[model samples]
Target: MTDYYGILGVDRDTSFDEIKKVYRKLAREFHPDVNPDPKASDKFKEITTAYEILSDPEKRQRYDLGGDPFSQFSGGQNFGFGDIMDAFFGGGGGNRGPRARMRAGQDALIRVELDLAEACFGAERELNLETAVACEKCSGSGCAPGTKPNVCAICKGRGETQQVTRSIIGQVMTSRPCAACQGYGSVISDACNECAGDGRVRSRKSIPIKIPAGVETGNRIQMSGAGEVGPGGGPAGDIYVEIVELPHDFLVRDGNDLHISIVIPMTSAALGTKVSVETLDGSREVAIKSGFISGETIILKDLGMNKLRGHGRGNLIVHVEVTTPNKLNKEQEELLKSLAKSRGESQDDVEIHHRGGAHSSGFFGRFRDAFNR
Candidate 1:
């Protein structure tokens, strides 16, 4: 008195195709290999039994008429193997034609070293690499001159062999790729000597690579159709070029911004002066304001790295370090003392203040803010 329709979550009037579709979904969900629940195995068995009995038109009709269909066989009855194969594997349990020898190739990757200037600005390079290419001797056909492939006699160009065997589920039909043909349906008896029937050969060749600006270390550039050729001279795969940026002599890069430190005389910082610094664009003079403290920054617009996949450029942040006269001569010391006295400062006069607290708007403040920035 098993209600197969109720077990499959379908009404009695449901069509066989609808029943099979539901069974496929339930099977994928409850199959032991996929579902971890212990009860799912028994649930899968119940659903599979429900589908097998309900899928057949005669079984469905007999069950509808209140007759027992399982009474005739002590073991399981016969069902077409294609039904199970199709339900589980998305169809194609029947005869399949030969597979093509040519297929898309795999992607390849390589790393290249670049200098700061080269990375900041786009550049082209010609590099040599060993990769697979169409064989010149065989013209990518894999056959020698004036010779061609022959149809496989074992599978008769079908590329597969089928057999039926009795199992717990009754007769089951199975098919596999033919060993003789290797699924190609044809055999290259007279293969090209240079390529050894693969239709391609490995050789060293030079290819040009164009690197975009602002590419950082570990950034990859993809070149389509620049990889290894396929087995039978099919379309080549893509080539990925990974960048390794070399350290610059003076400039430190952070994203698109560039950083450089420059030392200036204390007098120049106090009195204000323009100092020429070397930038990627060329030598540029940066103006220091009067009373400018050490550790302050000067930003030069459009002087950093060129923007990658974008417009314009970044800024060059110049860090200033004022060099105090450590060993002042007698005249210089006297002059500094006189200037300090004129500015109301003396040897014994002292003012104690915490950094970045109440009084933090002068030389030390600017210096701390510079480093913090």
Candidate 2:
């Protein structure tokens, strides 16, 4: 008698929902799709069957009463020693082998680099990749040219062999893949020279890939049927193209928003001006407002990268840095001093002159002060 709770690694008093959750989690972890381990797949199937039986009130009650629920004439009774398999697989018999060679191949992964703008706006590129493709000369068959496979004598074309043996405890019976044909039910006397016994050959392939807009680093793009070709001409696996972003000179991307910074003359800070700036779309003039404080941000709406998902676009934030004039001449200094006198102020008013002075209020004012000397 198998302990249902022990099989699922759960407490005896665990709730039905908890049992289901644990079973699903473990099943997903050990599923052939993820683990691909034969032993793990069997364990997962066992646990799944246990949960299915125990989670049902009637089935659990019947099992608890020890009524010999498994019937020899029923679907589960003779299902190969009362071992009920999952619906995802075939019946009690082992998987049938091909007359020739047959098996699917593995997928492949390739890394690609994209510029910030190209990644944001989406772009097309050609990829040179190496993978296993079906052998054209043999048409993915392991048999040599103009030849075919022969039935295995061990299993008589059944792909499996059954044996009965007497042990110390009692007599036992088991069925397994035929050794002569390795369960393929057939033997290839002359294998394909190109791919040897297997029906696949290694070769370089050129593929076109389209990267969607707003794709970030480490993102993956999947191409179906682009991976290694399956054995015996079976369906191909998938190809995953991983994205890597290149650092931009003037732009820093954060999700959807774009951050840009540039230095301008000090005079532009005092007086209004329009400076031409480069953006992904093209060059455009951004207004430098009158008395524009250093480090002030100018947000250009709908000018950033297109949203990776959803509608609309992100904002482009421009950070301004005021560049003060250097190498002042005597006449220039004198004119500045005269202008300061006319304005009824001197260099002592430096604190008050800058919008980001110590006495300034508001968030922008403080932010500007933090950015300046």
Candidate 3:
């Protein structure tokens, strides 16, 4: 009889967490991949067997009472960490039952472009998509009518097979997944022709998605359970609809604020005029006051993009660009000369601005005097 506690290098009253920590350290050192020495393999197996027996409370009690616990391991009942490691380390691993065919589907992503108006005002868009859906013929069973999968004869439903081979130490037993069943333990002899035993088919679908206001480019809208249908009719994954906002003709967006530039003649800037400005709502009038500057802006409240999460909309900014009148007639040129002469700027290099009987000077002073009106 082997002393399980002595093999694990732990006391009889050692905590399970402490025991697990010690066992993991020894496993790392004595694992065949880490240690080239032939004796390390046997030592690793001994410690693993001891750890398995001691980890289970009932099995440890039986071993403490001088009862055989090896019977339990031989029956291949308890599947633990050590048992799983054997499959990867070329040892005769414990029997692993058939793997299920059904699994959760994978998430999918698709990008859709939206009109600027559509993004400002929420709109419904029908998406044409191609995704995997459960096959209709066999209801995701992957079998034809009146027939089902049969147990694999090679591994006898165990999903793996053990083989003994000669090594330097002696006969070393190794286990591998059965080739015929591919670890599924069952062969679909009468596979469904539609999905070809995958239980899902590639099909086109039309899904309607609502485009929320204020959703800009690169924003993703997640639709739960709208992605690919998992193999064997498992639950569908989420579908992410990414937004790509289309460019507006005249308006450029900065956050929630919409900006547009309009050019007006210098006469319109001198004399007050009204202009038609297009907003998210519709065309609105923006008054350009007399002597409106070239780089001035007129903001319309609550006329921009709607807020995605909060109340109220953003502002629409109208950028004004005053253009000088070109191709003036003789009468217009004579009238402008008469107006300039009357203002006393026709002969002087720059009209001096007087402050308390003193002439203001310098570049900044000249600039201030030029636009003082």
Candidate 4:
């Protein structure tokens, strides 16, 4: 296998932060998005994979023990270090060459939409997923029970072969895996029919997932070891459950706070009234003060969504909008006119005048004044 340090173009003594910095720089330079060259893209992927493994302590430990992290390791199934090296770098030949089988398929993502109540209160979901599972016929092995695979004679079990290339200065050296044996240094003569000489098959599975309370949109619930079965009878990867919160009919969310707009009649704004507010739990009576103005907010403490990773709930802000009566009956109009007459004396014309100011007239002057203010 390529040295993680070498792949990252850093020294073995480099710190974790230094390693990350170097990886980011190299990734930016060689990323497929920035560099269209196929070779650069492949190299970028290789380096990124190497950095991902090395930066993680658990994966790095496994790699240090000569283990192929991408392959399955449980149940005595193992991958040769040579095969890992050949898989990343081409098997010492011009051809892509045979590669070792991998285990623990890969993690998958699925989106689930939940209402605000469900996101706050939590719920159980039954997921129908189609993934690769181990074959039952040969017990995860490609060979039948009685017979086993034979050693490959092409690469002599080394899984790779050396090549000599002519260069201007001298002979160049390269290595690749033997095509016949596929880097396993062995071939299954009587392969199992169930898995078609591989070790896994596609099957449908139903799993129950309990979404935790206080989960928000874009939050992921990881189901450990629930992913696809690895190649060659390896362990399974994890499955990530992505949450997508549905929009509520009456409320909009901000962090954990719930904002709602409530419409009240003009009479209700003048005369205090108790309103029945709907909530996830049930309904509650909220009192509106007399002489309430439009665009005013009433805060209901601890009535919002629960904190995703903390204790206590957020406040619910209710914005009030007073609806004015557009069409008034004769009696209503007469009563309003009487009320206005009692408030003050009526006048025919009222003249308003503005004192002269530097920006009171011109457009640009007003614009500049607006910005300065």
Candidate 5:
């Protein structure tokens, strides 16, 4: 006797629910249509037979008692049409008729590069792509200029055929897609030469797309009906435009905020000055406060990228980097030396500034002091 439980990889005392679950998983895995392995058909049959006997209460009882229940049926007993149909169709009862030749097209994706300014503000651009488009010669029909498709005689326009097979379980009837018309219920006479009867041709097309404001890298914009046309000239799918932001020369974007660094002379920082900065909107003047230090950040509100799908805008952050004079003339050196002596200090004796009454020393400490001020 064959052990149905072992075949299904389950315990002998397993419940019906568990056995059904295992059978379904194994059946789908080993089904001939899903798994192309040469032995898959035989394995599927084995799993089906095991499930059939174990799932029936009477058959299971007889099998558990070491009796073959199938032996009780004589050769004179005949299987009903519904029983045979159920065995082949899995209880679907009837056929589903012909399938449609034309189907909805598939969506496509392409990446486009955008400048930082273009991403900050909305823009319209043209894109070129190669995809399947409807054939102009046949007007989206698979037939030639003068002829049309005709009904298939083999399937009588039903697109399927019935067959009977004798197996160990008895005679079973099944229906399969007809080969004559390829399940389309019709055959094209004199197929279109331009599209090879598929009703579509591969061609390059240019389309205009609108990019909204504040679009960042990795953002996707959907363009409807811009994808490949279906095989039989069906509906066109959507084309997704993926945004790739190009590196900016002066700005670094983080979310909706923009950051930039600028260098100012030590004298300009101490005396206060105004400098022109190239922003996304345009060139604007930014004021440097007196006694400005390196690493100090100045925020310009509403000067950054626009908020995506929102109303407000982000701020532009400016980091000040004070530039020290690399070369000094003798007169300049003398003047600096005199100024330092007047402040009660020498070039060798560096003054350490305290912040919030906290005494700290080093480059990092000076950086912290700069920001603290």
Candidate 6:
């Protein structure tokens, strides 16, 4: 007699949970999929057979009494981990009954490119795609003209065939999907010619989609029942529109915020000015304060991208860049020199101070001040 407890590395007095734990561990170790050793498959089968008997209360009690449990079965029986799992986890092991011919279609995904402005304000788009749809000729029945499907005669509508075999334990009966019915319990006597008995056909369709405001890249919008129709005219799956944001000429997006850079001449930055700025909505006048330093930022509230699934909008951040006159004429050069002398900036030894009265001073005052802060 083989010691089932020793084979699973568990004691005879071990609890069912402990035995199951050890069995699972050994099963993974000796499984044919994990271990390529030819002998490992036989070892896994032995382990599974032991678990199948020991996990059952009646079978275990009979084994404990020195009775031959294999003698109780007249025909071959299926015993494996799948049986153990089904006993404990409420799952069906082998012979899962007939399979449904019609099933829900799979979800489909399509990429859509949108400009920055369109994404911010929302837009409508027309899309064309090819997908499976229910056949109109037979009304998705998969039957030709006046004929319909008939129950399988071989398996008697059970969708499975059983075979008896002799093994070491006893005679084992194994059931497999019926070849005639293909597990559907029925056979198509006369298949529809239009869809070739699939009950669905590939078709080109034009659909209108409404893109919501504030959708960003990688976001997906789902449209229910807009995808492919399943075989046998099952319910259609959903269609997902994946957003792909295109690069804008002057705008860059960060979350709900919009960022843009504007270049201004040194005079305009120093003396202050108003400039016409082009925004997604329209052109607006932006005020540039006097003495505005390069790299300074100005925020315009409610002028950015729209918020997704919420009210209001984000702010637009404007970065300013000051440009010095590189090709100054002789007159301009002399005027700058005169202005430099007026500010006592002609001499290199002249001391400069930041507006905050910080220790940093001179031409690099702003840089040092930024670091000090």
lDDT agreement with native, every candidate: 0.76, 0.69, 0.73, 0.69, 0.73, 0.74
From the highest lDDT down, the ranking of the candidates is 1, 6, 3, 5, 4, 2
lDDT of 1 by residue, 1-373 (tens): 9988899999978887898899889977865334545566568668766776788677678788999856433222312112444554566544477765654566788899999999999778876889887676765557776666788899898888889999999999998998998987878888889999887899886877789888989999876557777676544666789999998778878788887888999999999999999988789988999898777788898999999999999999887988988888999999999998898887796666455543446533553455456
- Please report the candidate that would top lDDT against the real structure: 1
> After TM-score superposition, what is the CA distance of residue 264 in candidate 3 from its true location, in Å?
0.8
Which lDDT value does model 5 have at 182? 89
- Candidates by TM-score, descending order: 6, 4, 1, 3, 5, 2
- Runs of candidate 6 exceeding 4 Å displacement: 1-95, 168-170, 354-373
lDDT of 2 by residue, 1-373 (tens): 8777788888767887777667667755654323434465467557756775666666567767875444211222111111112222223444654232444456778889999888889988888878787676665556676666676777887778889999998988877878898877777788879889677788987877778888889999876557776666444676789999997877777678887778888888888899988888888899998898776789988889888766878988787888877788999889778977897886875645344444345644544454452
- RMSD to the native, candidate 6? 18.9
Q: What is the TM-score of candidate 4? A: 0.66
RMSD of each: 19.4, 15.2, 17.4, 13.3, 19.8, 18.9
Q: What value does the lDDT take at residue 280 in candidate 6? A: 83
lDDT comparing candidate 3 with the true structure:
0.73
Off by over 4 Å in 2: 1-101, 145-147, 154-185, 309-311, 346-373
TM-score of each: 0.64, 0.61, 0.63, 0.66, 0.62, 0.68
Q: Highest TM-score, which number?
A: 6
- Which stretches in model 1 have alpha-carbon errors above 4 Å? 1-97, 162-174, 327-334, 352-373
| Residue-level lDDT tens digits of model 4 in 98-173 | 4445444677898989999998878889889898887766545566555556767888766677799999989998
lDDT of 2 at 82: 16
lDDT of 5 at 184: 74
For model 6, how does the per-residue alpha-carbon lDDT over 238-323 read when each residue is reduced to its tens digit? 77999999988787777888877789999999999998777787877999999988777788889999999899999887777789
Model 3 agreement with the true structure over 179-228: per-residue lDDT tens digits: 88887777888888998888789989787778788889999998655777
Q: Which pairs of residues clash in candidate 5, taking residues 3 or more apart in a chain or in different chains?
A: none
